[model samples]
Each structure stands twice: as C-alpha cells, then as structure tokens.
Target: MKTTRVAIVIPEGLSGRGGIVRVTAYLTRHIQAHIPDIETHVYRSRYSDNALLKHLTAPFALAAFAVKCATGRIDVAHLNVAPRGSTLRKRLYQAVAKALGLRTVLHLHGSGYDQYYADLPAGRQAGVRAFFARADAVVALGDHWKRFMLTDLRLAPARVVEIPNGVPAALPIARAPNATPAIAFLGEVGHRKGVDVLIDALARLKAEGLAFTATIGGNGDLETARAQAARAGVMDRIVFLGWVDEAGADKVLRAADLLVLPSRAENQPVAILEAMARGLPVVATRIGGIPQQVLDGETGLLVEPDDAAQLAQALAALILSPERRAAYGQAGLRRFEAHFSVTACAERFAELYRSL
Candidate 1:
C-alpha cells in the first residue's frame, strides 16, 4: 500500500500560545497516534520572534515548501488559516501545492471572518472567494461557519464541511470549592473576549451579595482588564495569570468551578472545549459555534454579549447551587466525549484525507 502523506501547515509560536497552533498540534498528535496507515509531516509555514523577523523569514518558508512538494510523496496540504496575513500566507502555500498537483484543504479558524470578508472591497472579496474556490475542500468549524462560507463566499455547500474543534478526554474534577465560589476565565483577557463584561459581572454579583473568586488566564489587554476590575472594586478577588502551557492550563482548569467567557466574538472556543473536557460547567455568550458545543440549559448557561447583568445572574445561579454545578459539569463531560473528543476529531480528518 502506498503511504498517505499529509503536511500540517502551522506557525512556530506553537509553544502553546495561540488557538490555531494548539489545534494543529492536537490534530498532528491524534492522527499520527491512531492512524498507523498515514504519515504526517509538519510544515512550519510561519515563524519569527517578532513582526519584522516574520516578514524577513517568509521567503525561506516558501523555499522549504517548494523543496517538500518536489519530494514527490506528499498527497495533501492541510493549510490552517485565519484572517489577514494568515489568509495571504496560506493562499501562497495552497497555490504552490495545487500548482504541484497536491490536494489542498483550507481549514478556516478565523473568528473575525465575517468582519474580515465584509471589510474587503467587492473585487477583493471575489478574489478571496476564488482562492477558497480553488481548494479541494474547505473545512468549517460548525454550521455557522459553513453558512458563512456557502452564503457569504458563495462556495458550494458540498465543498465546505463542518468539523467541530475537539479536546482530549476530560480532566479529573479536582477543585473543591471553599467558602467563596471559584470562577475561572480562560483565553485572552481583552475587550473582544468580553473581559470588561466579566469584570462588571463580578461587581454586579458582589453587589447582589454573591461572593466568588476568579482566576483569569491567558494574555492580551491584561493591564486594561486589571484596571477595569479595579474600577469595579473586584480586583482583589480576581487573579491574572498570563499564557499557561498545557500542564499549567490543566492545573488552572482543575482548580476552578465555573468556566466563564463572554466573548463578543468567537468561532468554536478551544478554551471552552477544554473547560468542558475538564468537566467544568461553562457560562458564555450565545455566539458563533458556542451553541454547538454548549447546549445552553443542558450543559451550561448562555447570555447575550455585553450584558453584564445577565452574565452575573447566570454566574450567581451556578454559585448558589452546588448540585446544579455538578450536574452541568457531568453533562459537559458527556457532551465533550460524544462530539468533541480528540479521537472523534482525528477520525473525521482521516476520513476527509482518504476522500481527498
């Protein structure tokens, strides 16, 4: 049997910093571990310690791409993509692979795609569509994203497939809550993530006499978030820990009771999926592919973005009821196993690869 080879294109900052890098890492790990028939190779398409260095190293990445494609054994190029420069870089790599007669898959990971596509001029939008149109398959995170590709970009529905982001098996529920309820927020602590909203919600909950402790992880606009928390008079109750690796993330997740992220923008939040995998009940906004992962009333609570009062109410409900919290946690774990486990994600990709 001929060996099935695939090139996983990702960035070099994959030392556990961004979401796309982590997803790429997980895909590589599970596919290689389970699918013995297939051979996987990683193509470091983007790498730099800084912005200026990234631009300078672009040609080298392309040269490496040329060499790998010329080797004559690669069957597919799985280009992980986002908006802006990510789209441009992946387009170049995909074009090169297609030019070399390899099957190309465009995996969309841009949460800001709607805005990004809308901001582009009509001609540029068409140009973007043409690039996607050239792909053998366009992978979407969920139905919402699939709709965006089909309706917005006018791509063929059959060409765009939905593959939800998956996490590994659930972590042991390790955090035992003390007198104060322990609430956690993972991902970037920026306005886009609704960190300001979370801060307001904390103040709102505190005023309502619902006490809790929040462990805010990840970076981005953290100083602003701290100021916001301080302004809300809840800074003392919140801890800001920036950019935790896999092991660090597990420790943080294990010690938290509720996983809350009121992001104003999102695609499927890998953080939420990881939280679910840890059997932590989530409180998040009802946006993007969140509804697909978080079954609102069943596994977690959902609120409208920028609505701090509503978010506070939701958090208070979970904080008030230990039984309800445990139930939500158990339900979330079941959902993670049923749909978002790493095995499920790997099998889906393997099937897609075989089809290509």
Candidate 2:
C-alpha cells in the first residue's frame, strides 16, 4: 500500500491545553499506533498564548506549508478549523492547497461557529461557504454540525462526514456514594462554559442540604467564578484547581462521581468524552453536540443551558442515588467503547483519508 501523508494543520499543535489540540493529538497517536499506511504531520498555525509573535511569524508558516505542498510532501491537508482567527488562517491554507491540487479536508471543531458565521457580513459568509464547498470533504463532530454544513453552508451531503471526538479508554472508577459525593467540572471556568450557572446550581443544592463536594479544573476566568461561588454562599463547597494538565485531568476524572459541563455553547467537548470513557456519568446542557453524547436519562442527564434550577435538579438526582450513577456510568462506558474510542475514531479518519 502506498503510504498517505496527512498534514494536520492545528492550533498550537500538541503542546496547547485546548480541546482541539487534545483531540488532534489523540487522533495522531491512534493513527500512528493502528494504521501503518498513514503518515501524520503537525503544523501549528496559531500561537494562542502569544499574539504578536503569531502575527509576525504567519508568513513563514504559510511559506512552509506551500513548500510542503509544492514538494508533494502532503497527500491530504487535514485542516482543523474553528471560528474567528482559525477561520481566517484556514482560508489561506485552503486556497494554497486547492491551487496546488492537493486533496483537502476541513475538520470543523468550532464551538460557537454558528454564531460567528451569523455575525459575519454577507460577503464573508459567502466566502466561508465557498471555502467549504471547494473542500474534498468536511468532517462534522455531530449531526448538528452536519446540518449546518448541508443547509447553512449548502454543501453536498456526500462532501460532509460526521465523526465524533474520541479519547483513550480509562478504567471505570469503582464508585460508591461517599458521605459527600465528589462532583467534577472540567473545562474552562467562565460564562461560555456556564460556570456561573454551575455555581448557582451548587448553591441551590447546598440550600437544599444535599451533601456534595465539587472541583472546577481547567484554566479560564478563575476570579469571576470565585466571585460567583462566593456570592452564592457555596464557596466552602467548591474548590478551584486553576489549570489542570493531562495528568491532573486524569486525577480529576478518576475521583469524580459525575462530570458536569454546562456550557452555553459547545460542539462536542473532549472533556465529556474523557469522562464517559472513565465510566463517569455526565450532567451537561442540552446544546450543540452534547445531546449526541449524553443520552439525557440513560447515559447521563442533560439540562437546559443557563438554567440553574434544572441543572440543580439533575445534579441532585445523581448525587443522591449511587445505583443510578453507577448504571449511567456503565452505560456511558459502553457507549464510549462502541463509538468514541480512540481506535474507532482513528479507523474512521483513515477510511476518510483513503476515500479522498
């Protein structure tokens, strides 16, 4: 078999702590391990932590990408795209790859891209659609994204593919209801992630005298969340662990009884997938690609976004019943193994690459 070379254009590459970085890293690792005919290369397009340096070095990066294509080094340009700056950067790459006659795949990872597109001017919106319509294939994280690509972008159904984010399998924690159930909130701690809503819900649970201890892991507006927790009078119940790396995330997942991510906007979060892989039930908002992963009452619970009352009710249900938590966790693990495992995701990507 002729080995296929894939240029994975990503943000900040594997060193960044963002979800897209983590997802791309997982796919690369799984592809290297399971598929021998695919050669993966990482190209960092965004220096997220440093803006001025990123702008200064943009041309050099583009030159490097063009050189790779000109030299026949990349068989497929697998571009991981998001909203805002990612869209701008990827448009250049798309044009370069198409001009060079390289097969291109746009892997959409944007959490708020729909809103971003809506906010764009009419001409720019047409340009964005043109970008997708020209791609050899577009990978959507879920059915919601698929609909956007088909109806909003008006791409042919054959050009769009649905592939969920995946995580390595983790040993399911042997969980028993403790004197106080330990809740875990993983992801950025800010309004977009609904940390404020979570704090409010925790306060509600506290007022009702439900016993639970919670931890918020990941880096984002910590002071704002702290203020919310303090004002809610639930400061004593929640612990903020600033920014958690991979090892720290594993520790948080292992100890958590249920994972909560009530984001007002999202497109399939890797944190939820990681929790499900570890046999932890999820309690997340019913938006974006969350419904696909969290099966409401079966695998876990799904509450309305920004609705602290509904979030509180769902959290209370799981915190009080160990049997229900265990059942949900087990079901989640089964779902993860069946659809969202690293191996499964890698196989799907390999198939996509081969087809293209």
Candidate 3:
C-alpha cells in the first residue's frame, strides 16, 4: 500500500516554543517513526524568512494553506485549532480543505475554549459550527474536552476523539543535594496560571513560620507576579528564572521536591507530565485534564483552584514528610511509564490516522 502523505498546518512563528508547537512537532515526528512510508510536511502561516508577512497578510494565509492542500499531494491535512480571535484564518482553511476533498482534523488545545466559544458573536458562532461540521474528525486533548464537545457543543459523539498529550523521553538531570525542599512552578507566569495564588500560599506559609524555597520558571506577566510576590512579603524565598527551554526545565524539575500548578484553567499541561517523568510529585488545582493526570492521592495532591490555604497545606505536608514525597514521586513516575510515554501516545495516534 502506498503510504499516506500528511500535511500539518500550524499558525506562524511558534518555532517549537509554545506547547502547541511542541505537541505538533512530536505528533508529526511520531507519525513518521511508526508509519515509515508516511511522508510528513509542515505548512506554517509564515516561513522563517517572511514571518512578518504572516501578520501583514493575515487574510491571505488561509488561501496559501488551501493552495498547498489542493495540490493533490496531501492525503490528510491536520490543523491545530484554538478558540482565539486569530483563528479566523484556520476557520476559513477548514472550508477550503473540505472543498478540496482533503480529510481534515481539527486538534483543539487550551481549557478556555468553552468560554471562547460561548463568547463568540452569533455570526462567528455560526461560522465555527460550519467549520467543525465540515471536519472529518476533531481531536480533543482530554476526556473533559471531549465531553464538552459532545454535551455542550452537541458535536457528534462519533466525530470526537480523545488523545491525551504525551511527554518526550526523560532527560538525565543530576539531583541537587538537600534541595531546600523546594516547590517549583514551571510555565508562563500570569494570573491565569494562578501565580498569584502560589505567591499568596507562600506568604501564608511564611506567616506560619514554614520555611521552603520556591523556584519559578518561565515568563509572562512577570512584572505583575513579581509585584504580587513583593506585596505578599514572600519575595525573599522566591526565585524567578525567566523562561527555560525543555532541557533546562528538566534540570529544574529534577532539582525540586514538588511541582506546583495553580492555573485557573488547563488542558493536560505538558509541564505536569514532564514533572512526573522526572520523578517529581505534583501539587496542582483540580481542573480540566489535570484531575485525569494527577490522581489526588496517588501521583500527587490536588487543591481547589485559587485556594491559597489548601495549596499551602498541600505543600507543607509534602515538605514535612520526605517519605510521602518519595512515595508520590515513585507513583507518578510509574504512571508516566504506563500511560504518558511518547511512544505509546504516538502509536495510538498513528492508528487513528490509518483508520481515516
């Protein structure tokens, strides 16, 4: 049998920096690994040299993607779709792919998609519905999202597929000695990520005479978070390391006793998977796909979103009990090997693509 040719269309300028870019990169790589005969090409809204043109000619980007799809060389065209305003071009490209007889997959990322869809203007909502209606398949990152698509959006149950995000193979990191019983927060630093909540929790811990260090990595709304940390009087114990790439993040993960994510909303965050793979216990809010990944008592602890006291208590417990922390870390590592491995996730995705 002739191998299928898959063309992945992504927004311009990601450059494998964002989570979506990482996911798309890994998905394409995995498809190539498993299906050797399957050729893969990535079509970005803008190329490296003319990246600025992607923004300048926003209206023409979809037309360009459509022209690529209509060349009769693509057996399947996969587009990463988010519910942001900039996704208008993707919406248009979906229609063009349908007209061109190219099988289309709309892979959704982000936990705020529900609000995004609900807030869309009526005309835009109609356009979104028409776009999804034309898709051959819709890939959701977690069961929570899959359920929302079926129950809330009323998308056909048969059309939605749930594929959880996977972590790449673990990188070696030398463990730090007596690492200050540190609590690490990785990823963008912003209100949406609940960095404020983490700061508040640290303040409460300080007030209660609890001693622990916090290492925050990544950049976004950093000034605001820094101001909040100062106001909370916990700035002394908090260290901000701006944005660290994948390898650097792994080193940070290995150095910490626990990982914290206090996001107001999330879809199976890659940070959690990477932390677990590195044998770090997690402390995160129970929202979106997080609950699915972090079993409350098994892999790590889960606190209510934006609850500083609960978040503080969870961190305190892990800090005081080295035995419990080790147990949770072990359990998390086992879970990663069992379910979140890249090879397993890629094989499953390849099967889905072949079925099409």
TM-score, predicted candidate 1 vs. hidden true structure: 0.95
Candidate 3 residues 199-229, lDDT tens each? Answer: 9999998999977899999878889988998
lDDT of 2 at 23: 86
Query: All candidates' lDDT scores?
Result: 0.86, 0.90, 0.81
Runs in model 1 with CA error above 4 Å?
174-177
Error of 3 at 157 (Å): 1.9
Winner on lDDT between 1 and 2 is 2
Candidate 2 lDDT tens digits, 1-356: 98999999987778877798888888999898889999999987755457788777776787888998899889999999999888889999989999998899999998988889989999999999998888999999999999988888999999999999988988646666567799999999888999999999999999999999999998999998898888889989999999988779999988889999999999999999999988899999999999999998999999999899999999999999999999999999999999899888899999999988
Model 1 lowest lDDT segment of ten: 170-179
The C-alpha stretches of model 2 lying farther than 4 A from their native spots are: none
Sort by TM-score, best first: what order?
2, 1, 3
Q: How close is candidate 2 to the true structure, as a TM-score?
A: 0.97
Tens digits of per-residue lDDT for model 1, 1-356: 55679987876635536777777778778887888877888877656747798878877988898788888878999888888888888889988898899999999987878889999999989989999999999999998899899999899988988888877885465556657789988887787799999999999988887878999999788889888888889988899998877777778888888899899988898888898898889999998888998988889999999999999999999999888888998899888989898888888988898889
RMSD of each: 1.6, 1.3, 2.6
| TM-scores of the candidates in the order shown | 0.95, 0.97, 0.91
Largest TM-score belongs to which candidate? Answer: 2
